[model samples]
Target: MSTTSTPDNLELATTAREMADQAPAGSLEKAVAGSVAITCATTRTYQEAIDVLGGIQPVEVRRPAIEFLERLAVAAR
Candidate 1:
């Protein structure tokens, strides 16, 4: 895949790198781990977690969280 370092892409990349630094090793494999744990550890089902996440977070944050939850659900199936 080819990527152009557009300003938006660069910014996103930098932010992702910063966030990655804050996470433990193997975190990329566990990107959805936190949401899964939260859903499992609580009474929330995956759909409920996806719906509720948007209400709790900003749109930018919620969008990715929901997407991650969706991808997790697909992987589970």
Candidate 2:
């Protein structure tokens, strides 16, 4: 499988790297904090993108719903 990093994936990786950099020496807190940072960064990116799009109309909404219904009917045959 090919490995590629999307923007959100890149952000998560970057957050993990920063956490590694700041982790305390020989402490369990370091691992816990690093995990929390990665989770928070990934969640924040997903939430922010969702929030931005939640208010906008999709391009498909500009078209009549009947058009999609008709297409679906044909595809189902």
For 1-77, candidate 1 gives per-residue lDDT tens digits of 11221223233333334444566876542343354344434433444444566563334455665565554445334
Per-model TM-score, in order, reads 0.46, 0.29
Tens digits of lDDT, candidate 2, 1-77: 11121234345435444655686875544444344344435454434423333333433332322232223223323
For model 2, the stretches where C-alpha displacement exceeds 4 angstroms are 1-7, 33-77
* Clashing residue pairs, backbone N/CA/C < 3 A, model 1: none
Q: lDDT of each model, Cα atoms only? A: 0.44, 0.39
Which predicted model would earn the best TM-score?
1
Q: For model 1, what is the error of residue 76's alpha carbon versus the real structure, in angstroms, after optimal superposition?
A: 1.1
Candidate 2, overall lDDT? 0.39
